[model samples]
Target: MTLEASVVHGDWEYQPVRLPRDVTRLNATAELGLRSRFGGWELARTLLYADGTRKVWLRRKLSRMREGAAV
Candidate 1:
């Protein structure tokens, strides 16, 4: 899996590296850039907003019940 990201700022080209797997964590720098440093976020959000993205993990059903469990 390969990740790709690109951005444009006042005719300046910006390309950032993305990991090829699901991110287990987001550092401060990554969070900051995503929140305010990049312009492509709006475009990316728009694209994703229209097309539903899948959640990484969700168990379908429970096989056995533990004590004091609801399900």
Candidate 2:
């Protein structure tokens, strides 16, 4: 998978998350938020990594939440 990021504001750029070939992209934002917070970053580089990581995480969380509700 390829990761792409866009320059947003003040030396900070938003990274678009790309999942690896074998990984699945979750469709939940809550999960992403939980995971993002869990990942925890204290530096610019770490934050960059966390930002993308959160997307994937949230996607998955959302997917699961939907599934659970359906049942």
Candidate 3:
């Protein structure tokens, strides 16, 4: 079996003026983590307030098929 790996990223911004009052600023990171996990991604790194926004890095492996002549 051939294996392939890829990195995924998720980001969220906290806009005090545009976002709803019920939205917590700290929850941005948590939300990103949960969403990534739900998509079968593993958390690789957490960047808080990087460039004034929350950033998350995730990684996952997948199976790849090789093109070859059938025996």
Candidate 4:
């Protein structure tokens, strides 16, 4: 998966996820769950298009993270 992430606001970082029309609901939920389970990501926003494609945003708290430093 490609990551298109940036600091929007607050103490959180966000990633945008795109689910194609062919993906099933169960698969999508599992995918999101995996992100949360292993990547500390949470659902931030979602939009479902008329063509069945979905756009999802996932966010995780920064918690005092610093660039070039191990958390």
Question: Which candidate gets the maximum lDDT versus the true structure?
Answer: 4
* Clash totals, every prediction: 0, 8, 0, 0
Computed on alpha carbons, the lDDT of every model, listed in order, comes to 0.32, 0.38, 0.41, 0.81
Question: Model 2 off-target regions past 4 Å?
Answer: 9-12, 25-35, 38-71
Q: Is candidate 1 or candidate 4 better by TM-score?
A: 4
Candidates 1 and 2 compared by TM-score, better number = 2
Q: Cα RMSD to native, each candidate?
A: 19.0, 15.0, 12.0, 2.7
1-71, model 2: which lDDT tens digit per residue?
34454334433334445443344345333434554677431123322244344322112223444446646
| Rank ordering of all candidates by lDDT, starting from the highest | 4, 3, 2, 1
Q: Give the TM-score (vs. native) of candidate 2.
A: 0.24
Q: Residue by residue across 1-71, what tens digits does model 1's lDDT show? A: 12244433443333333332343335523643563444332212211123332122111222234212632
**Candidate number of the best TM-score:** 4
Candidate 1 lDDT at 57 equals 14
Model 4: lDDT equals 0.81
Which of 1 and 3 is the better model by TM-score? 3
Per-residue error for 55 in candidate 1, Å, reads 18
lDDT of 3 at 39: 58
